[model samples]
Target: MRIVLVLEYDGSNYCGWQSQSESCAIQDAVEKALSAIAKEDIRIVTAGRTDAGVHAFYQVVHFDTLTSRPLSAWVRGVNAFLPEDISILWAGEVPDDFHARYSAVERRYLYFLLNQSARPGVHHNKVGWFHVPLELETMQAAGKLLVGEHDFSSFRAAECQAKSPVRTITHLNIVRQGNLVVFDLRANSFLHHMVRNIIGCLVYIGKGKYSADWIDELLQHKNRTFAAPTFSAAGLYLAGVRYDPSWLIPEFSDFPIISNGVLR
Candidate 1:
C-alpha cells in the first residue's frame, strides 16, 4: 500500500516523465494505467523527470498495491484506463517515509513566455516561448538575480546526471500577462534541463540580449556555454512538490487533488 499520485499530462502525447528507451512515456502511460487497476505489475516513482515536451501540473507518483482499491478506485480507476492526454488527479495513502522522489523538499517550475506579436489562438499548446517584445520590467529585474543559493553550473544540463551542480533558488518570479511572460521557478533540486536552461538565460535577459552581468558571469563560470537556448518545452510546468508537515495527509491541503494544477 504506498499509493500517492496526482498526475495530469499532455506533454503533447508522452515521452517525458521518465521510463524511456525509444519514446512513449509518461511512465509508460502510468504503468499501463496502474497495470489495469492493480491486476498486478506496477512500478511508479516520480516527483521529477520531465523532458520531452515537458508538462505536468502537479506530478507526483508512487506505487505498491495489494488491491483493496478505493480511493475512488485510485481515482476512478486511473481515469478509466488513461489515454486522452492522461489524468488521474488524485489518490492517497502515503507515508511509509513517504517519497514521491525522496520526500521532496521543494520543486516548482513554471517557465512560460509568450511575448506577443500574435500566434496563440487558443493558449497555443499551453504557453511558452512566443518571442518579440519582452521587457517585463527587465524580465523582472533579471528574475531578482536568480534568488538565493547557487552553483547552477550555468543552468545545468549538458547530460546532467546531477551529483551536484549545487542548487537552492527558493524562488524567482518574473510575471506579466497580456502576452504572458511568467517564469516562476523554485527549487531545492533540479538539474536536467534546469528550468530550460534558466529560461535560456531568461530569454537573453528579456531581449536586450543578456546581461544581469550575464548572470554574475554565468554563476562565476561553471559553464554550459554560458547558457541561452533551451527555452521552449512548450512552456514547461510541473509546478509543485513540497513535502514536510509530517508528510501531510489528513485533508492534504483540502484535497481536490490538492487543488490539482491550481485551477488549471
Candidate 2:
C-alpha cells in the first residue's frame, strides 16, 4: 500500500531534505525511523527538496510499504524513532497512482525576515536578519512587479537542475507585522533558490539599493548574474503544498508553523 505523510521539522539540525551518503539529511532520519517501524527498507519521495538550514511547515512525502500498519503507527510510532527536530504530523493511505511531487498543483514558501537593528538572540537560526531599517512600501511595490507568470531565470540558482526556468508565480506579497517582515510567495513551482534569490533582490530594493524597475529588467534579461545574490537560507520555509482534494490528504494548518513562523 502507498502511504502519504505530512511532516513538520526544524531543518536547522539536518542537511536539507535529500538523503546523503553519510546519512545526515532530514530524509535519512525520516527513512531510518520509517524503516524501524516497518521492519523493512523504506525509501520515500517528497513534494519538494528544501536546502540546508531551510525549515518546513508542511512537507509532504509518500512511501510504499508492504508492512500494513495503522496510520497512527506511521505518525506516533515513527515519530518515536525520529529525533526531536522532526515529527510526523499526519498519515493517510492513498491510491498507488498518487505521487507526492507530480500531483502537487501549487507550492508556497514563506521567508521570515527579522528587520531590526539588534540580531536575534533566542531565534538564532530561525530567521534571516537585515540590520538596516527597510522601507516596507518600497519593497511592497517592487514585489508586485514580480507577480504573474514569467521566466524566473534571474532568480534561479546556478546548480538548479530544473529543465525549464519558466514558472508562474500566482502570488507575491511582502507584509510587515511589528518588526518582522514576512515574504509570502506561491507558484506552480519554483526553481532552486528562487525564493531566496528573489528575497535578496527585494531586500536590496527595500534598502534603497535599487528601484522597483530593477525586477522588470532582471526578468527581461533572464540572467542569474543580473540579479541580487541569493539570500540566507536560515529564514526560508517550505510552508505549504497543495494537491487535488480527490487525493484526500488531511489538512494541517492547525500547526503553528503553518500560521506563521516561530513568532507567529
Candidate 3:
C-alpha cells in the first residue's frame, strides 16, 4: 500500500527538506523514523523542497510500503521515533497513481516579515526582520504586477534547476498586522528561491526606495541582477499543496490567519 503523510517541521536545524550527503535533513529524519517502524528501508517523495531555514506548515509526502500499519501507527508510531522539530500531522492510504509531487495542482507559500525598528525577540528564526517601516499599500500594488503567467527569470535563483521560468501566479496577497507583514503567494510551481527573491523586491518597493513600476520593469527586462537580492529564508513557509479531489487525500487546515487586515 501507498501511504501519504502531512508533515510540519521547523527547518531551523536541518539542511532542508531533501536528504543530503553531509548534513541532516528533514527528509532523512522522517524516513529514518518510518523505516524503524516498518523494520525495513523506506523512501519517500515530497511535494515541494523547501530551502534551509525555511519552514513548512503542511508539507505532503508519500511512500510505498508493504507493512500493513494502521493510520494511527503511521502517525503516532512514526512520530515517536522522529526528532522534536519534525512531525507527522496526518497519514492515509493513497491510490497507486497519487504522487506527492507530480499530482500537486497548486502550491502555496507564505512569507512573514517583522517590519519594525527593533529586532525580533521571540520570532528570531521564524520570521524575516526588516528594521524599517513598510508601506503595505505599495507592496500590495507591486505584488499585483506579478500575478498571472510570466517569465520570472528576474526572481529566479542562479542555481535554479527548473526547466523554465514561466510559472503562473494565480494569487498574490499582502497583509499587515501591527508590525508583521505577510505575503501569501500561490502558483502552479516556483523556481528556486523564487519567493525570497520576490519578497526582496517587494521590500524595496514597500520602503519607497523604488516605485511599484519597478516590478514591471524588472519583469520586462528578465534579468536577475535588475531585481533585489534574495531575502532571508527564515520567513519563507511552504503553506500547503492542492491536489485533485478525486485522490481523496486528507485535508489540512492549519494555515496562519492574517489577523490585522488584508491590504489587497
Candidate 4:
C-alpha cells in the first residue's frame, strides 16, 4: 500500500525535511516513528523540502509499505512516537502512481514579517523582523512584477541545483495587517532560497532603499549578485501543496496559526 501523509511541524527544532545522517532532520524523526510502528525500515518522499528554521503547515509525503495497518495507525500510532514539535495531520491511501513531489501542480508559501521598531519577543525566531517602517504600497507594486513565468535567477540561491532558473509565479500578493506584513506566493515550483531572496528585495523596496521598478530590473538582469540578500528562513512557511483531483488529498484552506494566535 502507498500511504500519503499531511504533516505540520515547527521547523525551528529540526535540520529541515530531508533525513540526514546526523539524525536531526524532520524526515529522520518521522521515519523512526513509522519504522517502529511497521517493524520495518520505511523511506518517505516529500512534496517539498523546506530549509532550516522554516515551518510547514501542510507538507505532503508518501511512502510505500507492504505492512498492513489501519489508517488511524498511520496517524495516531505514528504520531505517538514522534516529538511534540512534529505532527502527522492526515493520512490516507494513495494510488500506486501518485508521487508527492512530481504530482504536485503548485506549491504555496507564506512569509510573515514583523515590521515594527520593537524586536519580537514571544514570536522571536518564528517571524522575520524589520525595524524600519515599510511602505506597503510600494512593496505591493514591486511584488506584482514577480507574478507570471520568468527566469528568476536573481532570486535563486547560488547552491540551487535546479536545471533551469525559470519558474512561474501564478499568484503573488503582499499585504499589511497592523505591524505584520504578509507575503503570499504560489508557484509551480521554487528554487532554493527563492522566496527569501525575493522578500529581501521587497524589504529593501519597502524601506525606500530601492525603487518599485527595481524588481523588474533585477528580473531582467538575471544575475544573483544584483538582488538583495536572502531573507531569514524563520519567516518562511510551506503553506500547502496542490495536486490533481485524482490524488484525493485532503483540502486545507486555513493558514497556519502560530504561537501568538496570529494567522499567517
Candidate 5:
C-alpha cells in the first residue's frame, strides 16, 4: 500500500532533508524509524527538500510497504522509534497514483522576524532577527510586488538546478503583530532560496535602504547578484502543504501541524 506521512522537525542539528555522507538528516531519521517498524530497509520520498537549519510545519513524504500494518501501527510504530526532534505526526493510506511531492497543488512557507533592538526569547530559535526597527506597514506594502507570475532569477540561488525561473506567487501577506513581523507566502512551487531572497529584499525596503519602486527594476534585471544576501534559514518554515481533502487522516485531519525541521 502507498502511505503518506506528515512530518515536522527542527532543522537546527542536522544537514538538509536528504541524507548525506557527512551528517544526520531529517530523511535519515525518518527512514530509520520506518526500518525499525517494517523490519526492512525503507526510504521516504518527501514533497520537497528543505535546507539545513530550515524548519517545516507540514512536510509530507510517501512510501510503500507490503506489510499489512494497521494505520495506528504506522503512526505509533514510527513515532516510537523516532527521536525527540524527528516526529511522524500522522500516516494515512493514500492512492497509489498519489505522490507526496508532485500531488501538492500549493506549498506555503512563513519566514518570521522579530523587528526589535533586543533579541528574542523562547521563540528566537524559530524566527529571523533584525537589529534595526522596520516599518511594518511599508514592508507589508512591498510584499504586494511579488504576488504574480514572474521570472524570479533575481531571488533564487545561483546553484539552483530548476530548469525554469518562472514561478507564480499566489499570495504574499506580510503582517505585524506586536514586535513580530510574519511573512506569509504561498505558491504552486518555488525556486531555491526564493523565499529567503525575497525576505532579504523586503527587509531592506523596511529599513529604508530600498524603495518600493526598486523591486520592478530588480525583477526586470533578473540578476541573482542584484538581490540582497539570502536571509537566515532558521527563520523559515514549511508552513503547510494543501492536498486533496479526501486524503486526510481521521484524527489529525482538523489540526494542521508538523515538525520543526531542525537537526537537534
Candidate 6:
C-alpha cells in the first residue's frame, strides 16, 4: 500500500532533507524509524528538498510498504523513534499513482527576517538577520514585479540541476509588523536556492542598493551572476504544499500565528 505523511521539522541540526552519506540527514532518520516499523527497508520521497538550516511547517512525503498497520501507527509509532527535531504529523493511505513530488500543484514558503540593528539571539538559526533598516514600501513594489510566469534564471543557483528555470510566481507578499519582515511567496515550483536568492535581491532593493525595476532587468538578463548573493537559509521555511482536491490531501497553506518575539 502507498502511504502519505505530513512532516514538520527544525532543520537547524539536520543536514537538509535528502538522505546523504551522513546519518545527520532528515531522510536518514525518517527512513530508519520507518524501517523499524515495517521490519523492512523503507524509502520515502518528499515534495520539496530544503537546504541546510531551513525549517518546514508542513512538508509532505510518501512511501510504499507491504506491511499494514493503522494510520496512527505511521504517526505515533514513527514519532517514537524519531528525534526531537523531527515529527510525523499526519498519515493516510494514498493511491499508487499519488506521488509526493509530482502530485504537488503549488508550494508556499514563509521567510522570517529579523531586520534590526542587533543580531537575533533567541531566533538564531530560525531567522535571517540584517543590521540595516529596510524599506517595506520598496520591497513590496519589487515583489510585485516578480509575479507571473517567467524564466527565473537570475535568481536560480548556479549548481541547480533542474532542467527548466521557468517557474510561475503566483503570489508574492511582503509584510512587516516591527523589525520582522515576513515574505509570503507562492510558486508552482522552486529551483535550488531560488527563494533565498530572490530574498537577497529583495533585500538589496529594500536597502536602497537597487531600484524596484532592477529585478525586471535581472529577469530579462537571466544571468545568475548578475543577481544578489543568496540570502541566509535560516529564515526560510517550507510552509505549505497544495495538491488537487481530488487527491484528498490536507491543506495547510495559511500562515500560522507567530509570537516569540519573531513576529509583532
Between candidates 1 and 6, name the one with more favorable lDDT.
6
Model 6 worst lDDT window (10 residues): 253-262
The digit string of per-residue lDDT tens for model 5 on 59-146 reads: 8899988777887878888899987877777788987998988888788898888888888788757889998989877887778888
User: Tens digit of lDDT per residue, candidate 4, span 1-264?
Assistant: 999999899999988888888998999999999999988999999999999899988899999999999999999999999999998988999889999999999998989999999999999878999999999999999999999999999999999999999999999888787999989999999999999999999999999999999999999999999999999988888988998887889765643354333473
lDDT of 1: 0.76
Q: State model 3's lDDT.
A: 0.90
Roughly what TM-score does model 6 have, to 2 decimal places? 0.96
Candidate maximizing lDDT: 6
lDDT of 4: 0.91
Better of 2 and 6 by lDDT: 6
**Candidate 6: where are CA atoms >4 Å away?**
253-264
In terms of TM-score, the best-performing candidate is 2
Winner on lDDT between 3 and 6 is 6
Tens-digit lDDT track of model 2 for 1-264: 999999989999888899999899999999999999999999999999999999988899999999999989999999999999999999999999999999999998899999999999888898999999999999988988888988999999999999999999898888888889999999999999999999999999999999888999999999999999899999898888898889988654656644543344
lDDT of each: 0.76, 0.91, 0.90, 0.91, 0.83, 0.92
Q: Which stretches of candidate 3 lie over 4 Å from their true place?
A: 254-264
* Per-residue lDDT of candidate 6, residues 80-112 (tens digit): 999999998889999999999999999989899
Give per-model TM-scores.
0.37, 0.97, 0.96, 0.96, 0.93, 0.96
**Candidate 2, superposed: residue stretches over 4 Å from native:** 252-262
Clashes of each: 0, 0, 0, 0, 18, 0
Candidate 1's displacement at residue 45, Å, is: 12
> Which pairs in model 3 have colliding backbones?
none
